[model samples]
Target: MANFIKPYNDDPFVGHLATPITSSAVTRAILQNLPAYRFGLTPLLRGLEIGLAHGYFFIGPFAKLGPLRDSDVGLLAGFMSTIGFIVILTIGLTIYGAATFGQEKSSGNPNDLQTKKAWDEFKGGFFVGACGSAGFAFICLSSIPTFTV
Candidate 1:
């Protein structure tokens, strides 16, 4: 029998998480599976690329103004709204992921004390901080041109 975590087509009911199982763990797993030469290039990279592109396109120069700024007021408003949404969700998920996985591995797993301590420290490390940061950048960049005109 397949695990409940891995969704299946036959039953078609047990969906994935309301969001994705995204964390540094998923990114780390991909890193471990890849060749050293491909260190920074991965599916995660492509996804980030697409996300940045989408954000850019949404708030791009062309979209913000073309003559009838009145007609585009709604689109501009929505772009800012989603950027805010993604940013807020990113922060919430960061806190939740840190608490959930940090406790699971370090607090009670009977692993080596140093190992657990290191994990406890690293759970809120640089990459995790960067996730929140990227969201912030997106929110800022996505809202920048829209508000000025």
Candidate 2:
């Protein structure tokens, strides 16, 4: 009993998670563990790269326009609508990330952002952040006619 128990306890999360592992399963596991840059470096780089792209997209308009027209309701609304998307999305992601990393997003506290084991989930969040910026910018650009003379 102890002999089998030791092997079973090796990795509580993964060991015996599946059994009767097949030839293709072995091949797939080998492929996933392959030391290729595509699987390893790319995900890391892509997450940071997409984050940078989103940050630039967020900052570009502010630097050019000096500041958004907060006093003017129309421009303010549009501008807020534009940036609000980014802010909320970023905050939401931070919340989720913190949760995954076992931390809190509130309390005005300094954060230690730890990447979770779920790379796929992180990638999805990164993509959503980028796409939200793009979509909000597109909406703001398209709605300009009504705001202008």
Candidate 3:
């Protein structure tokens, strides 16, 4: 049987966290065969998954907090909040990445190169995921007419 859970030693992000596991054998097998996973794009894929879920589920609650509770206005607020979140996250991650990058460069470890590459991919994936999901949500939500002619 193929291992569904990634080994902790192989996953730098697994610190203090449970190893990732597919819920079923079929899902694990299918995902394992995907080019994205093969190419180490799991971070990007995970980011997209997280962003899409956040956009769908949190937007409504955010919209509720908008002034007058108008649908269009609420949606606009939600969209803006999404943008703001992306910006903030980007800045924070950039700082974290920079610090890690410097440490990895100085560590003199043979595996640092691979770690750096993975970190770069993770950052790119996170940015793309946030932007893509936010853009999609904006397009979908903005199409709803606030007032009928």
Return the top candidate by lDDT: 3
lDDT value, candidate 1, whole model: 0.45
For model 2, how does the per-residue alpha-carbon lDDT over 43-135 read when each residue is reduced to its tens digit?
434555565467437544643354543444534454455456566766776567666766323332122123443444445546565655556
Clashing residue pairs in candidate 3 are none
| Candidate 2 wrongly placed segments (more than 4 Å) | 1-45, 48-76, 103-149
Put down candidate 3 lDDT per residue, 28-109, tens digits, no spaces. 7888765445444455564565555554554555566756366546677877776777778767877877776755643343
Best by TM-score: 3
Pairs that collide, model 2 = none
lDDT of 1 by residue, 64-142 (tens): 4534345746454545554554456446645755665555544443322223343333333323343444455546755
lDDT of each: 0.45, 0.50, 0.60
Q: Candidates 1 and 3: which is better by TM-score?
A: 3
Query: Which candidate would rank higher by TM-score, 2 or 3?
Result: 3
Given candidate 2, what's the lDDT at residue 117? 39
Per-candidate TM equals: 0.29, 0.30, 0.53
Q: Which stretches of candidate 1 lie over 4 Å from their true place?
A: 1-47, 53-72, 103-149
